[model samples]
Target: MNEITERDLLDFALLTDFESFLKHSMLTLNPGMPFLPNWHIRAIAYQLERVRRGEINRLIINMPPRHLKSITVSVAFPAFVLGHDPRQRIFSISYGSELSLKHARDFRSIVESPWYARAFSQMRLSRSLDDEATTTLKGFRKATSVGGVLTGLGGNMIILDDPQKPVDAQSKVRRDSLNQWFSNTLVSRLDNKETGAIIVVTQRVHMDDLSGHLMGSSDQWEVLSLPAIAEVDEQVPIGDDEFHTRRAGTALHPEHESLETLRGLQKDLGSYDFGAQYQQAPIPEGGATVLRNWLCWYDRPPERTTKTKVLLSIDAASKDGPQNSYSAFSAWQVQDGHYYLLNMERGRYNFPQLRDKALALAQRYEPTLIVIEDASAGIALAQELRSMGRHRVKAVPVERDKETRLFIQTSKFEAGHVHFPKDAPFIPDLLAELLAFPHGKHDDQVDSMSQALAHKFSGYTLDNLH
Candidate 1:
């Protein structure tokens, strides 16, 4: 095609589609760089258009980093929205002042470009700056970092992009404070709550990070979580009624991040970090001792016999409170050199209540042996249970830490020697705790599980296990 015809076609596309506008803005900012197109960017643009059209008000996007998230949502989307409706006000937020300002400047440049004028002939900027822009109409674009002041100010679209840094996510105090700010300060700064839109764009940082906190709260939020690698067959919605059939183990954006590069990052960051940043799941799959996919799930174990060595492992907490850990126990049936988890329970209980529950469970399951970590509530509970000669109890001293114990038994779990009940009520908790080992909020379940494996297979004879 000729240059004028091509230019006319491009300008037409820029006015018609947000995805085309994103590509134009990307090229405008990065002069000589090639714009490698990906389906994820189109998906994000569709969501943003939905927001502009007032179809979606509250949206949460969790995806891997370096996928043009800021360019598309933070910078390009706002300018595109303003091109369509200059009366719309926008606010872009980030974890730091520098990133927020950078996004604002990029948005400003796109709006000020010569081609932008051709696409939106009616739109004109009356006042503009590196971090703020105002149009001829009563609309503006502003930037602010997390915890920045927005008193007496509101926007039609408030965009939160990476609200918490990776280091900040590790600190509960920081995460909680950021969450509180979003709930109290940010959410309140909506020009019109009925029609206003709020979009959060960030990678998964922790279990209780902004995404988790918002999702856990009573407030409703629509989540679009795109992991680096698909764990199972999925029909991910792109835009309109279209869906991308992402098969298992396929990369989300292979042009940007190949499978080889992702695996290298996983190896370097380890499962815990990779799980948060890349997988969009706070727990690792295979990097941790237990792989969720490798999990050997069984409906039930063979009929109990005298030869079946049943062991009960307990990791008890002294008190019952919101901050306190839950007292947990797992009953395993070791048969034919393989371990099958039969019964599991986790609850917050006082000492007397804890003792009664353990005794009752012991009586019910009639385990061959019961093991408890001699720490905190476990020591006293072990003494009480030991005094009751009805159950054979063994209090294993906490010579090593909980992670160390779980680490030592990693091979047995990965070797497919351990099995869990498929349809148990507590299966979700059990899998979540096991996969999140060494990093999750509560390690009580893992502690009890590792204690059981340690006591039963302490001999280190792989032959018996294999």
Candidate 2:
């Protein structure tokens, strides 16, 4: 029997543990600096495990730039995979030849280091291999650009990092070319028909980018979307059995980039670029759907004496199931031909909760009229509120669809009439829904705003108040 040395045990740990390999290999790349593992790094480690186990064949990861996406996916993962199985073929693709070659060199450096050699002594680069853009350690690893020719290359695992350059993402011609190469050329280079794995890591650049196209066209791929800041509560799967839930407003990497710094960057980038680059939303900010310049921000409402009328507008949810829509309500103070948005409350609730919320708002605001859309639960809510005789509730029959109503209100927003409080916690939610408009996931906020606008323009006077 042969005895294993201390070096062999250290090598065994590196081969079996992905995170440990990543931390130890950091010095080879960035010599004296510390390697900090963020939440996203831990999450990426879990995903790589799934790939190694063959649990997921096709995976897509979306995250903002400068978040160590390339380091984790293109550099560390390939080295770790190749360490365990020296003969495993890895093909990495990127936006340009230079970037692709850099990754190849980095991977080679990690694997050729003394530390890695001790751990995986069996894995060695072939003597005849060229250490350039297309390095081949005798079928062990290779890297190439997106559109590069691959006449006789095949890979057991493929990693595509930032396939689209941000500047050219909007060009239809460039986007189509990349998509074609991926579908036709890349998919055929997989060594195995049933078990080969492919991973895509990129920040969303357009609605027609590769990530968007794949997610829209098919459901075969498992997607892991990590936005720079948490826009929604998400339980992101780190590994097969572990998950991390990021609450809304939480930064993905707070130590590296503070929440305050990220918020400043968002403001500087504006809504359009920020949505695509940071939020993983490709839609332009305040485009044809909504006017960005028309959004007016106020420190507070006008003087108490300047307020002539107070009203509440409700858009109720139709069902009470788990998938039930949210019931949204907007409180407004109308004065001087302008509607000052005072408060907005939106949530998924049953009849009892909805009644209690509406009653509570009425008690606090003392609104003269409560405008409710006469549809589904709206009718019942309005009737019940009126039956209490505490507030005047008017059921307005909505003649047009939500889109039409929003379009009508677009002119008001364009004219800079609709105003919102600047520092409210609900401001971001309201803006996200308003800017995304008809394409957004939730329209309850839009419907409630439209209802309020409909009442403002209805020519109802103070004398006619019930």
Candidate 3:
């Protein structure tokens, strides 16, 4: 391939009229848009195309604020999707009717624009249906003003556009209502076939706020996170050192002028708030029962070398072999004021599979005491483990609420006592749910941890004493 001349590049940039129209329309809304596509937008487009081809059913885009993310994904992108598939059903929702209507209007404007006419001459915007929001000749239908109007629709592309506003997103009641609306109303409207749902919003609140509820789910959900500051190493699961380094570098880089200004605006707001808004991290207070600063201050435990007394806690699944509960088996070595979270087994599993794992943990870690929560439908499985000659198999009952237990353990984690492996697979969910206390679901890991820790920290020595 020959190297294209600067003149040719510039000409091509201009000659790409349809692309220019798209860029110009976007510029009209956000003039200072970044030169390149952010990761979240790219991911959304990729998923949207896949859905158009009937690849995936659902997706969730949870990004930090002030990145011009919503306009790219929610407002303008729907029209773009319609360009590809005219018959697609699109429904967009926001916190309030007014905001939802505004997004719908934006979509209508794009479809009704002169540029739209010039680019796609045959296409025409459809009249608004009383039940349906709006439709276009491209066979794409869109609706913005919705609160509880998602019943009876099928094959609809549900766009939950910031269902919780900044203020409402922070409120537990408001978050619960929106989640309920999505579940009871919006999600119910989909046909028997796989439905497409897109949740695009700035990270205004907790992980469990809305996006967190959908984690580890196979019902067609993917979280597309884009932080304003690009981390140093730029890996998939970016680490702290590289994250901070890259964030600082992005703030100082001259080409990223607007991002630097955004950083300054964040500084004006406050660092923790900035972290929540722009870093795609969870809100410190919104469903965050445990303080992240305190958690970050604590360090991971040193790898075990010599023989150590260990307590293993298991939270078993209740229903399906794969879709039921996540079977998490965590081992803790309570010595020298350190709680080492040794191994974790989390995924869909049956009794036989879970039994095999229990045996494996016993053989591998040789735990002194085994604590399995005698909750959920698999209580008899605990007895089966004991019947199999698993030494020190203790089935402990978890009677306390998750919040109370988490509150008890939060103090320990803050005191630099609870240590988890940096690579523990369940660590992310554990930390996320622990911080996002009452609101987050699947408190199994935290519950098991709290039970084991409560047992240890309270100076209880008898195995299976609870």
Best by TM-score: 2
Estimate the TM-score of every prediction: 0.65, 0.79, 0.52
Off by over 4 Å in 1: 1-4, 284-433, 437-466
Q: Which residue pairs in candidate 2 collide?
A: 11-119, 272-285
Per-residue lDDT tens digits of candidate 1, residues 292-352?
A: 6667878768887767888888998877764567889889898877889888898878888
For all predictions, the C-alpha RMSD in Å is: 14.1, 4.5, 12.8
- Prediction 1 global C-alpha lDDT: 0.83
Runs of candidate 3 exceeding 4 Å displacement: 1-21, 27-44, 128-140, 151-155, 195-199, 216-219, 235-266, 283-466
Alpha carbon lDDT of residue 414, candidate 1? 79
Error of 2 at 227 (Å): 1.6
lDDT of 2 at 358: 93
User: For model 3, how does the per-residue alpha-carbon lDDT over 1-466 read when each residue is reduced to its tens digit?
Assistant: 9988875654454333223434645765556964543333344455555555566656666666544555666776666666555666676666667766666666666767665655444456567552244445435455544475555556566777666656666677877776677677777665553455554454645555677666633455655565555422233322212232223225322344466586565656544555555655654573366666565322555556654568888878786442245677777777766677776556556677888877888888888888788877448767787776756666767767778877877777778777666544345446655665665445667676777787653445444343
Deviation (Å) of 391 in candidate 2: 6.0
> lDDT ranking from best to worst?
1, 2, 3
Clashes of 2: 2
Model 2 alpha-carbon drift over 4 Å, by segment: 1-10, 127-137, 192-194, 284-429, 456-466
For all candidates in order, the CA lDDT equals: 0.83, 0.81, 0.60
Name the lDDT value of residue 174 in candidate 2.
94
